[model samples]
Target: MKKKFPIIETDRLILREVLKEDSADMFLYLSDKEVMKHMGLEPFQTQKETLDEIGWYQTIFKEATGIRWGITHKENGRVIGSCGFFNTHPEHSRAEIGYELSKEYWGKGIASEALEAIIHYGFQHFQLERVEALVEPANSASLKLLEKNGFKQEGLLRHYEFTCGKFDDLYIYSILKGDVVTT
Candidate 1:
């Protein structure tokens, strides 16, 4: 049987499946130079690109390979960002987590809330023993966020990823199932 897409809710945000309707909101930030800077992709040029991205999200979920949720506000119902696990390995009980928020919502504790909800879900629902994240060294905000959420930096994977026509080093951070108090 296929697993249904999970929808997680926090006090202020909803982490639900990324739908086709979210493309415009997604495009708003996906096309931002700053938001896509460390994301390994150039800013999206068109809504078509955003549609392709939404399609990728659906594909991964359908294949049971990963899950990406559109981060929506409880009050406004706008998809302000997205967060989820990709590169999932069930045999290894691990997955990589990634997220991005609109610039307008930065530093409002939104990302932190979304991360907390997803991390909890990942551990409980996905049975993930280890949830990892690859973050660029220059992304101080992400580094701090990971640390605050109980993810410990393992080490720098030198020249780990080739993106945007160049090699980039990324810090590998992970939070074990026991690392945080997940309920």
Candidate 2:
């Protein structure tokens, strides 16, 4: 079953549903080449592209296929990034997790806080048995973050994704329901 969209709050951020108004903010980072380097996403060139992406994210929620949260700063209330679970398989009780933060927000612990809340929500609300993440082999920060959250490296997928005009290797990590211990 699809978990309803909920406004997840933490000490410094709020994970909420994306909005059309967020397109401009999304464009800020999504347009940066450095930010899109690891992921296979192209740097968006126009507000139209960001708007279209936002529309797609909304559609994902409406279709009950997946849930993506716009990570917003509580004090400023601007979306700094996004995180969510996709490729959900109700029968298997599993989902793939993905996330990205603006370069300015990197190393701020913002992603960790937001991720913890969402992971907790996934387990408690969706009753998921396992949650997985696919990260670029060189994405050290992400690897560390997943490890901090108890996700174990399962294996490597060679040439698994074509991103930034090249095939990229991905490291698979997973955490089971029984392994979750919310901090």
Candidate 3:
């Protein structure tokens, strides 16, 4: 049997499954050049692109490969961003975490909240021994968020990936299950 999509709730946010209906809202930020700058993809030019992204989210979940959640605001019920684990390796009990928030919602502690919820969920439900995040060195915001969440900087993978027409270096960050402090 397939597992149902999990819904994670934070104090002010709802991290739920990404639905096709979220395309428009997703497009709002995803189409922003600044938002997509470190995402390794060009800003989405059409709703069709957003839909494809949603489809990929569904596919990963269905295949037991990974999962993504639309980060919805509890107050306004708007999907202001997304956060998730991908490149999941059950055998190794590890996965890569990725997230993006609408620029409008940046610096408001939203990403931090959503990230905490998912890190907890990933460690518990996914049985993940390690949750990792790959971030461009220039992405200071993400680096700070990861560190605040207890993820340690592993090392830089130089020219690790080619995206958006150039090679980019990525700093890998990880939080081990043993590193988590249960409150």
Supply candidate 2's per-residue lDDT for 82: 95
Candidate that beats the other on TM-score, 1 or 2, i.e. the better one: 1
Over the stretch 1-183, how does candidate 2's per-residue lDDT look in tens digits?
655678999899999989998888899989988888777788899999999978878887888678899999988999889999889888999999999999999988998998888899999887889999999988899999999988999999999987667889999999998897744
Model 2 whole-model lDDT (C-alpha atoms): 0.89
lDDT of 3 by residue, 1-183 (tens): 878899998899999998888899899999999999999999999999999999999999999899999999998888889999999989999999999999999999999999999999988888899999999999999999999999999999999999999999999999999998633
lDDT of 3 at 145: 96
- Compared with the true structure, all predictions reach lDDT values of 0.94, 0.89, 0.93
Could you report the Cα RMSD, in angstroms, for every candidate shown? 0.9, 2.1, 1.0
Model 1, residue 9: displacement in angstroms? 0.7
lDDT of 1: 0.94
Cα lDDT tens digits, model 1, 76-109, are 9989899999999999999999999999999999
Regions more than 4 Å wrong, model 3:
none
Query: Could you tell me the TM-score of candidate 2?
Result: 0.94
